[model samples]
Target: MTAGSFLARLHGRTATGVPRWAVRVAYAISLTVLPSGLWRILSVDLRVPLMDAPTDGRPPPDWFGGEWWYVIGLSAVSETLAFLAVGLVCTWGEVWPRWIPWLRGRRVPILAAVIPAGVGATFNTLLWPYSMIMISLGRRVDGGGDLGLGTHGWQVFVFYASYWPLAAWGPLLGILTVHYYRRRKAAESVGVREDGARSPAVTVSH
Candidate 1:
């Protein structure tokens, strides 16, 4: 299969009226956090030392030992959350998968997906800009002195490059959420079932 066809299959079936571009955007949103997640795994969990150690004989942070699990867990959790955006443009978001216990084969409540995603999108939209401003002013978002990544060329470049894609995360999620809302609303208006069947509309007699 061609690359385009492969991606189409991989993305699964989208809800009726969801534009092709929206499906691609949802997939892209899911990948925005990946570089930073991988960077954390490499630097902390694997102890690759992407940042410099203190020169004054200070010991490494607790994350190097007892707290190492936190680094791995954070990366895993963040990636999983980002990946959920894929469901926004796919059938799985409209209907719960059969593997789910009580919710299996049931139509998913629209608000159940929209509220959390909308909240997340709003939070991220504000967060990354604040972080960039703080960093630009030579202040850490956590109120620390320096990030220990050094002020020189390659270190700074690598650090920013790893996380820069996060700036797009919020906007992309917001777009996907809007598209999801519109598509689901259209489906509901016509009494369209998850499998594309249209139920007869009931008319109320005056």
Candidate 2:
């Protein structure tokens, strides 16, 4: 099967009643994380000069001390976590996957998902905008200004352009989390009513 069809089927099985816009936003969250991940990977893995050069004639700290694998691992971990945002609108967030050993087929506790997502949203909300302003002022226009990534070169401008989208990541995740909570709550209420209706009535004999 083609990749597109495969992804559609995969997403379809997990999510029910998720709004189209929310799913789109989930995808956007993944996209927003890609550029910085790529930049980091390129700089570290390929030994490319994508990052800012050393300031003050002192060498930049060896981010893992020149270990290439560490850089790759960091990038992989980051993108994987970012991709999990899709679960907000997908079925897997509500129901445990069958592949999971003991938890399979169990109804996922709503708060289990909501709390972490909500916390992440709050943290990212505070972090990304400040980050963007710093990048815009420090790197984009300021040529190694103290507030932003302190690298000077044409590459710095490219870096700013690529990483700027990350500023939107926090707000978008916050929006998706709100929608996810509402839909899950509504579904939970409906499930509770269904269970109540199906329950057998008890009769007492005197």
Candidate 3:
């Protein structure tokens, strides 16, 4: 394709640039994280293991500051991530939300999201290796526990069973991020810039 058309196509092709595999991965990861986020919010138990010391294959009883407080904190973080997932689907990632007041409905610069998301996806993909290291060798810096269910045979088993979901998340996000970038480059080749670039208009997906 000519440079102009190639760039022009970015606006439309962005949707496609995000591969089906990545889309499904984003959906799966977001879905799994959503329930976990909700559970973290509603549950009274924090169940977050303390990483004050190195793990001994068993969590320290007092690792979490406390069950309830820990749960609340964990819930907030999970919900934040869940909300961020909307960026993957919506142009809001390209603009500030109306609820945001002063910057409400303002266009988000591409650099803002791409730089972070691209880098984030890169590192996030690295998590697979980290996870493998944790399982095979162990962690060097103690911080927190993986979001496994509990310290029971079934709990561990289920943790493993569901854990595979996250593995898919990173690669999928990488694909999506790459797709977004290429599409953006193409859009630049054309004339369609983001909302704030010239006008304050916003475009919603059909």
Alpha-carbon local distance difference test for all models: 0.78, 0.73, 0.52
Model 2, position 153: C-alpha lDDT score? 81
Q: Which candidate tops TM-score?
A: 1
Deviating ranges (above 4 Å) for candidate 3? 1-23, 32-63, 136-152, 193-206
lDDT of predicted model 2: 0.73
Backbone clash count for every predicted candidate, in the order shown: 0, 2, 4
C-alpha RMSD values across all candidates: 3.1, 4.9, 10.9
Report the C-alpha lDDT of model 3 over 124-196, residue by residue, as the tens digit.
Answer: 5687546644643323223355533234544444444443444554566666566666766665666455642
Which 10-residue window of candidate 3 scores lowest in summed lDDT? 8-17
Cα lDDT of model 1 by residue, 1-206, tens digit = 99767865875667666787987788787688888888777766676666665678664454434577787788888888887888897788888987899999899999999999899889888888677667756677876776444435676677678877888889899998987888889888888888888987789999
Determine the backbone clash count of candidate 3.
4
In model 3, what is the error at residue 189, expressed in angstroms? Answer: 1.9
Clashes of 2: 2
lDDT of 2 by residue, 76-190 (tens): 8767777878888776777787798999878778789888888887887788777678566654323454553545687777677777877888889889889988887776666
Off by over 4 Å in 1: 1-12, 56-66, 142-148, 201-206
Cand. 1 Cα-lDDT: 0.78
Give Cα distance to truth, residue 2, candidate 2, Å. 5.0
TM-score of each: 0.84, 0.78, 0.59
